[model samples]
Target: MAGTNLKCRECATTYELEPRYVCEQCFGPLEVAYDHSRFVDDVGALRRRIQGGPQNIWRYGDFLPLDGPPGPALRSASRVGLPAGCTPLLRADRLAERVGLGEVWVKNDAHNPTHSFKDRVVAVASQRARELGFDTLACASTGNLANAVAAQAAALGLPSYVFIPSDLEEQKILATGVYGTNLVKVRGNYDDVNRLCTELSGEREGWAFVNVNMRPYYAEGSKTLSYEIAEQLGWATPDRVVAPIASGSLFTKIAKGFEEWLELGLIEGSVPTMNGAQAVGCSPVAQAFDAGADVCRPVKPDTIAKSLAIGNPADGPYALELARRTGGAIDAVDDDEIRAGIRLLAETTGIFTETAGGVTTATLAKLAARGDIGADEKVVIVITGDGLKTLDAVRDTFESYEIEPRLEAFEAAVEQGVHV
Candidate 1:
């Protein structure tokens, strides 16, 4: 494995790469540390090797925290589960025009197997779980992770337990339940469910809670989004990245991915301006960034963007630091703006993204309206999940015309601008 050990982000303490996510000495988050000496020596060969590998994230296995080489045998076996990454990075010219930007791209992660970016994290965490001799897969999710964990576990022939807020979207609940996993819905929000899962992780043996005990490995999965963006852009980084912040993991890890590639000479460009998006109802990270606070003050979530409703974001401070260091900002949008964002992206780019993506799109628009983005800057806005997951958000947002299947009725309705 290129990943050597788990290193504390705060104290720099190291530990063996087991199912650990926090440092005992400083209680800071632990992340996978790598030794890329071999890849550094042959950048050209490394590029060739990556291009020649599988279409999924396994192509970038060298950067991921895997136990052994992602050789033919391992790749073939891993194919049994859902393969994530390599989603489209489309140039949204119309969207750019709408936002008054010069160049804009959309990293539509909703194209994944589970229709969300959580598939990428679940794939990596579940693989590491199997490597560590865990027999079951589990997670406490906002919505998308529940669906991804259940589907991946089913594909891997592993028994799984998924915990989620009882009030999650019915679409997500139905999607997850279809996979035959044990779905447990607690009577609280995402944070409450996460707390329960954390306690259960310690009590339940032979269980791999992907976002808890296995979080260090799980969080590394988000880095693949950046890897794909750079590779798809012909090995170049964009001028800015606008991605939604849930637990702040994905937002920060995307920057980490660019840093790793730049250090290894794989991609050419400085780290992009990191703009973090959030719903006004659950904008702890944005609040901290706006207030110039070192720590986030947790808030109770009350947003339609349920997928990004993490009140107390674990990586809040790190996300704030990254935004400030990169000369970017963390902005929050209200539900009305979120809904407008969803409609704007779909109309302009033809990408129907979930509420999380709405938050991102609206934030990007806010930045553009404020002239925060330069006219010639290349920006990438990440759409985390498909719009279908949050169908209610678009309900009654637009009007539908009903005709009596007659040309006269259609003509009358069209002329009157109302259904008759």
Candidate 2:
């Protein structure tokens, strides 16, 4: 594990791993690099390390680029990231059969502390924010990130400042507010809030922006989803997987996870076909991928999935390439289709996922109908957040079966097979 360096993904130029994310030589992105040999002959050793470590993301610290593991004082007080990795990998047999797939898995990340996958990224970002000598945490969020930043900061006793669109769901805003963040609701959409945060980061001082400055590290947390999936599957990959894309980072990182695990000899399997879902209302990434563009064009946000409403994704270009390289596609479904997706998953899996989850499940049905998911390919669908955050999106899907609280009414309904 010695001589670890940060290497430019573009030019292969290496540098001492420091508090930097971009390449100095080629201006390309710099990513954490390691001696692959460390993982070459120690799968059992690594497995033991993970089993012995705390039940959080730290179990995969060897794969992480931490300068060194954080101290106990900081780790103990960390409110957000108490090693929040091991999400359930349900067989999803009933759901898969209903969706017409062979073998299906649901990576239910809603079990995290903050009830969303954002907790994984925020945990890493919060740790790095501390290590980088910052006392305040801030972010430009759609919904989930705002809540995660506030919750993580509160857990660590770090002051938090957050910004988001004014039109965000009441539940999300309240979630962050309850954590005592200096929350600012911008008048426009998510993109507007992001622009303001970017400007603030440039003009302001003494603040750590989770989605910006600490972003590279924050994004790395998404890779843990892949790591857990493979480990839970007994060190193998699924045939295909569907993810909900907003900034497009999640889809790309999940792919990177499989690649790194393979390179480390931690898992032996082919990479999953990584398709992504987006709302048709705001799908610049999907549009760019469909149009064969190298970059995603930013657009106005207008989707029920507020958490997945980043019109201008920082990782959109990389995401498109990942989908294409893996023989997958990024597709967008309409509001109706998205709502249907949510209902379908809830009825079949007994899991109430947010709009993004609906996007994934609905798109799974769409792809299955078009024969994108063959009858025998093993599929995994990621459910990132709890549905309670956006109840309004699916509140109308059910018909009112209201009746008087009487035995005659109940009998009438029962005679109509309503109870069944």
Candidate 3:
């Protein structure tokens, strides 16, 4: 287990690390807790080891629940999983200018193999599933996760079952089905599909539902994003980070990652402000934060950001606590604002992010406008998925000029502010 154990988030009890995500004693969420001493005796040694390891998430194998670093045999594309992580952290000077921030950067996870941040989580879960003797993989996804799990399972030669809302983007559905998995389209939202998957976990033997059963390991994948940010910034933490909130796991895990690095003396700065973004149509976590309450009130999703439409966010309370404790805030934006955000980012930074990214970007702008974000503070916005997957959200929002293929027609369109 690499000296890692599963510990209850609410209770102080710990158990052996396994394919477990819920505590048997208190039923609280189980998280991977590590014995940090095993990974390093000193900060310099840890840095060297991590720097010398694999370029992907495996570089931090010492912190993960893996048996060891992935062997050389598992390095290529022909193997079980494609290398995920170490995505670019771009300096968005133009985006910063547009968003009214002194400095802004983007940890663009759209570059991942599945074109979403879900690839990182799925990679860890799939590897651990193999170790735990599970030959099949399954998940209830929004869109990005469906693509990641299905593609990863196909890569590993595992039969997979992926459940999703029937109304997800066609690009995402096509992407998942092409991976050759048993793609099941449920006629409900993500939470509904998730509930059904939980029921099936008990009935279906020898199947690993990545998000439902292997969540502890799966969620740990998000910590790698924080690690990459710190390393990419020359081993320093940012002043603030804005992340989209769906199930709230990513935002909380990012806070966890920063804490872990600070504990290990890898980074010296105080924890950054942990802000969250959500669509107004499904902003339970944001609403709870605004009300100064711990309990998130669920609402049926009615937003174009289907990826962030988790009405009942699983880690809502934890995310709310982190935001409050870190002196940060959570905010929500409407669908029109989210669309504007998508165009703003692509126009300013040339990063075509999906609706989740739109939520984060739009919320960041709102925060900046409200003077919540300091003009000199360094900020990083996490872009979780690619815009290509959700083209429907912005298809009618744009126009293509049907003009004659002549220089005079182009000049007239350009002069009249028409599409050229």
Candidate 4:
């Protein structure tokens, strides 16, 4: 499908694709409704087109909402490449050995433009911002989203305004601010900042809130991760996927990505299981899943995995659906587990993931322990952000172990098998 109409998910009523996000008829959430039959007519051609196109996520433009040939925004996207969607599908042999899995891979998105996979979604969001005639782009973020919004908007020549919690990582806060955007630090947690942003959207007219109203298309960007994973695995879907749970959007959208690829015949097999991983202190969705609830109950944040601390995730219900349909599991890990997960990943795979990735690894460990993930199953764990970004979390857990410019001390430490 070249373009799509919007259909309400709840009522099945259709609407024209406009700037509106919600259904005017039934007040239901509107989603992109593609002409699937027509879109599937040339799946091979679609694959060839994507293979021959630029390296960014827009290589699959035929699947997106673009109205014509690649526009100026798309051209710019291509030139930069951002090396966005084509991140490494690293085979974690060491990690597999530790976890006792026959096959395990890490989709390392920490290498993105702003040092997180948020760039993929935010890239599409920023492009949509320019396409929809908005001069300013904005979002409510705990950390990663803020960094992405500032960087993408700045790169795209749009004024950016990021609203973030005051208790966010100092590195993340400074990273966004250094982009020279308008960074507003709210004195509460992420949920509070999100609430404020939701209210402000009503008052702001020309501003495009990327994660709010511009979110539907913005969320579509996350599908690229799943798309890449499938393609990298030789045009077949994996057996399982474990991803960090933030607003629950990423995990749900990644599953959607694989589903769309299957529907469009981009992949030859059925979609993989989508598992959700969360930090224990901020795991509202995990609690809901554990309790067999339909929706996640909101809670106050209390986790070092600040990036995944969205207690009131918007896509929690969808996440539950994805996991249940894939026969996957969702679980949470405590702060200590998160830290150990990070260390385990770093030691085994040479990927320095923040606590969010730690959550995924820790949950993957738990899933393996519960015999949920099979030894021979092909599993992909997403590492969203770099560990160095949240130095505070693991600061005391690690130290320099400096030896005062002495070879003798280094020899002693080496003999002791110590981290020097």
TM-score, cand. 1 vs. native:
0.98
TM-score of 3: 0.97
Which candidate number maximizes lDDT?
1
Residue-level lDDT of model 1, residues 1-420, one tens digit each, is: 879999999999999999989899989999999999888888999999999988888888998898753454554433448888899999999999988999999999999999999999998999899899999999999999999999999888899999999999999999999999999999999999999999999999999999999999999999999999999999999999999999999999999999999999998999999999999999999888888898999999999999999999999999999999999999999999999999999999899999999999999999999999999999999999999999999998998789899999989888999942
- Models 1 onward score TM values of 0.98, 0.93, 0.97, 0.94
lDDT of 4 by residue, 229-249 (tens): 887898889888999888888
Can you list the residue pairs that collide in candidate 2? Answer: 56-83, 57-83
Model 1 off-target regions past 4 Å?
Answer: 69-80
Per-candidate clashes come to 0, 2, 0, 0
User: How far off is residue 172 in model 1, in Å?
Assistant: 0.4
**Per-residue lDDT for 18-70 in model 3, tens only?**
77788888899999988787544688888888898777888888777877647
Q: On residues 106-179, what C-alpha lDDT tens digit does candidate 2 reach at each position?
A: 99998988889998888877777777787899999988888888888888888999999999999999988999
Q: Specify the poorest-scoring 10-residue window by lDDT in model 2.
A: 71-80
Off by over 4 Å in 4: 68-83, 412-420
- Candidate 2: misplaced stretches above 4 Å? 1-5, 12-16, 22-27, 70-75, 78-82, 413-420
* True-vs-predicted CA distance for residue 5, candidate 1, Å: 0.3
> Which lDDT value does model 2 have at 310?
86
